[model samples]
Target: MDDPYKLHATAMPLEQRRAALTALAGKIRSGGTELGWQVTWNVDYGDFTWLIGGHINNIGDPFDDNEFSSETKAVERAVLDYFAELWGIPPPHDPQDRNSYWGFLLTMGASEGNIYGLWNARDYFLGKDLLLPEHSSGDGVEPREPVLLYSVESHYSVGKTAHVLLLETPADVGARRYPGQCPIEGEWPQGVPATGGGSGPGTIDVHALRALVEFFAARHHPVIVVLNAGTTFKGACDDIAAVNEILAECYSATTGPSWQTRPGNGGRPDRRSWYWIHVDGALGAAYLPFFAMAPERADLESGIPVPAFDFAVPGVCSMVVSAHKWIGSPWPGGVYLTRNRYRMRPPPFPEYVGSADTMLAGSRNGQTAVVMWDFLARNSYETQTTEAVTALRLARYTEAKLTALQHNSDHVPDLWVGRSPWSLSIRFRRPAQDIVDEFGLSGMRVQVQGADRAYVHLYIMRDTPRDRIDALIRRLAEPGAF
Candidate 1:
């Protein structure tokens, strides 16, 4: 019996709507029991929820002129300022000037950020030094094609981004070196491309990367490097400092017709930077800074012993971090930060919203910025530092617990655990299907040493307490309890 109230246009009764929402809320709350995923589900956005009621559209650039919609663009500015300060990016001296550090909240998670960052890099390199001018017959100028390099473990969005932007991806270039395998010089099916995938998770083989950079440099092509700060699978972090050093070497190296150069020779050593490094710190960028800034972690000297994959890295021209992942925002949101010099690659123009169209998205999520701002405002730096320390400690505890279980068990013979020193993702042997489903674990079958192995990943979030981890460990240790 189809009730007239259930038809379209005629809205459901207030009571029915309330009841439906209440039921959904309960189911969602129940799902929050197992905190094995990356996001913190228990986050209360608090007073910022009020902003959702209004039709707020943060169109155009936040840093540019705005006179139309009365959205909370100012809060967005504060959020960017906080991140800029944290990442060592200096803001423009003048408020109206768009020639320094520029950043904005993005709508489509870190994927959007990745696209924006790569787009910026592509435009920057192409527009900097003209290689060839366009023909008078209406053909566009052919700039030196920029090569893109990223680890195999980089977010799948990176590959998609390359496709969307019409850039040559690694797969397109045919650089397919599996982990622990190197490409044979003469045996390559086609000409060797840029960098090969790293042997470790979320890392780029610096040796291979150098080779790739050199290969492109020989042809005078610009290189763009994407270093993973925290990867999706095994949570491996590429050595940003090492990569920076390699790029610096390539940037300053001298090459001439005879491979010999003197002061008066035409080979001025390509004084312009030949490479750009963009840190994909989507998972770690939000919290790692807190760990690095904590008082207890100060004695550790650089906290994680890595110089960090933030703006602090000299070669890092841009970075993208997810606010939804570590910062506990309700919706999928992220921040993309780049040098002001690189941001204006797309010439500024008057947008319909009265501001310049500088951002990746046309009509951006206004509420996302408000939520992020509210979260950041509520959580102080010291509190965030404590939270970061706690997350790392929990990861260590999880790893130790799994190791202990492996030590005591005979069934799980080759229990391989993979995790970076400063990451929250703990990768280990996959358990029974039921247990995995109960805990909401992310499982995948991966190849290790030419053997297929089933692995499950657990992400330690802020709300994941010690007791929750203990419960999971107990179940895992139980005989025949897989």
Candidate 2:
């Protein structure tokens, strides 16, 4: 035998193999941590968090601009410019002033993407001189008023940004998250800007907002109006078109009715004001352009044309979209699109030691960007929309199955109904967890109904097949399974 063992093993190094495998295992475990988060909603994290990259086509991607050799970068440039417009920056303003997609700072995840936009908005709008309140400005200056307005439904990062801004770092941007409803009685905030007084409840109310705009129209508070494209829990969108309408009306006339003080008592709104909409679509925005809000009843197609609410929208200044969750990317990746590149600002913080422009990460792993770019280069709105619609249909189909499974459930004693696809939250009642155990006993692992009075949860996806759906229904309705 001539070195049988070595020759058979092809002289591969076991040490190298061991090292690679160890690294991979650690990655898998870390991935679980993120997967478990499930966008802070925790439950349906299974339906769409780390879906792989086996095929060349996926609705979860929109990076298809890479295929054009004749104008690959050109296409991206055009797209960037389009986004610049979408974010409401005039020509030669925002990111258009500098090249982004190429010299771009790609993020490792959506949080980083949000951070990136936050940095820009903070820095470009506020400047480094007053970044730190405690630190001498090198010229001895006091800190400027730092604030960003968002809803309570907003992710926790806004508060994190505020923490960073309290420091002396130049990248800090203080953020203020507005409670969606009133703390006392579900009312909105009231103030006339420069007056700096609460006009109302400081909450988000359409009519209340109109009143505040009027009350402070003489010159309003100069603040950033950060809007959420998709909230984490409910996945509902704040009306953009209507918001635009509100802004237009408020700015046009400084005087309007106020719920704060009577017109007879007489306090007027300041009008010197303006603001921007920073879209936090970390979980929901990516799917917006392509998915129908209500496939069961809308005249929309697989991907209905939506109002360009990106920078393209008149007042929209920036946008953040997560690639990992809905994009189906592995673990991490996100993109921050902005209109005013110069306006991009970083919060002053000791934690931030690098360029005030790039958010969170000064240097990110290139692999994520490669994957993100690849996804965008190979997918289209139609494909993505169709896939999302398919997912929605799957969800609808699952609902029907649940309906059938519980058709005669009145006699079953512990049977229930369920719903999904972010359309509507629905549930049915059951007395015991025995029916819940039925799924696990049948080898299809599923948790007992949660939150909704103990009804099983489902987040049916686009790829689920009809036959499988039918089988699931059959199993649930199995004689005595309840």
Candidate 3:
């Protein structure tokens, strides 16, 4: 076979290129049973096929239209409005209202949102005016350098974002990566340890987090926390409400007279602590609200619980949700939402775009916004509730079947199987390589009951039906499957 990864110096014949694409499309259709990821496979954008012919770019802010006539800012605004209302923050009624929500469509999924949110938090605490020159001075008490805190279970993007933003981490400070602003910590060298052995798997330990926040808050360092609404592997959500309470407590403790009374004594009381909470809700934020609103649809009596991790929670400053995860899109895209009060002022407006470049990527895909709008408009609140309920029900059914296979099998009597609370994924002993490839399963190695074990997980999406689950179970029941 020719090297598919290589690019030929000369362009390929049009007939040959068309034949290759047609063959690839057949492969994709045949492998549609791959249900190991959190993406909805049953999506058809045939009505929007005309968009491929035009070059549409949503340059600059989604709420503001640039000179480019082909932009879809209006549809993008409607999409943002839908998410803002869903996440418990009202949409921007007026462009000048600082209290209303302000955000833009993301081109690179949740990673871009994470970077943008943390970048804003870092600048906000550092007292750097976004619209001013690099060395321009600010008119407030200069805050100490900020520290980044996130659970070990968070997506890899969080740690990468920390590095990109130049924020201090436990490992960075210990290795003397930079000036090492925050004091050294104990036990959590990589990141904040998560609770997995206990009932709340993949969730951040609130007590441990509170202690860490207090240690930094007392030392006068601003803190930035990245909470997970639905983790990648285990699908766990951290307790945002509990973390907010801890921040409030630390804030009160740091603002005492002992820290406030300085030599400057400008008669203006100063706050000694600053904190920002950004929720990385790539999977859950898109559909969890519907589960919350219609709890009667799910089997909540079985102990699975849905927690709040949006703007409704007092301390949550910003959040990001992927359109390709819960809500299916042809390509990777998402939205990053934050209040206008928290939006960092962009650098001087660009005349080329005729609008302020507030978004991370100045040029974004207008087609993503239009697709998201179409999905939201076609699916009403009740329809979303039904879909969410149905997905959860299928997940429960799969878990039950897997558990039965473990108990009933004599060859693999000790088969390990588990699922986190309110999770759409189920973990079991890793099957043979052929079965894994056939079903598109994701594999991981973890310590289970004090021993290393290989596990594979299956994510139940809207396209994952009961028959597909049965087929997966049948493959696992084969002789020597484990």
Best by lDDT: 3
> Can you write out model 3's per-residue Cα lDDT over 5-107, one digit (the tens) per residue?
3558998878778878888888876755787888887888789898898999999877677789998889999999999999998875355665578888888
Better of 1 and 2 by TM-score: 1
The reply for model 1, stretches above 4 Å from the true place, is 1-22, 92-99, 128-143, 170-201, 254-272, 298-304, 345-348, 411-413
Q: 88, model 3: CA deviation in Å?
A: 0.8
lDDT of 1 by residue, 1-482 (tens): 65433546877888877877787778777866665567877786566656777788888888764776567688888888888888887664243343357788889888898998898777656554211211122222222567888876788888788788887643444444232222334232222222332224546667767776665555556678888888777666788888888777764573321121112113222122456788888888888778777777754323457447887777888898887788877778888887654443344576556887777777888887878887787789989999988888788888888888888887655457766667789888888877788788898777665677888889998888788889888888777765
* Candidate 1, residue 226: how far the Cα is off, in Å: 0.8
In model 3, where do residues sit more than 4 Å from their true spots? 4-6, 130-142, 174-188, 197-200, 256-273, 295-305
- Cα TM-score per model: 0.84, 0.56, 0.90
* Winning candidate number (TM-score): 3
lDDT of 2 by residue, 60-120 (tens): 1123233313222333334434334324443332333332321232445656656656665
Better of 1 and 3 by lDDT: 3
C-alpha positional error of residue 1 in candidate 3 after TM-score superposition, expressed in Å: 3.5
Instruction: Supply the global lDDT for candidate 2.
Output: 0.43
Clashing pairs in 1: none
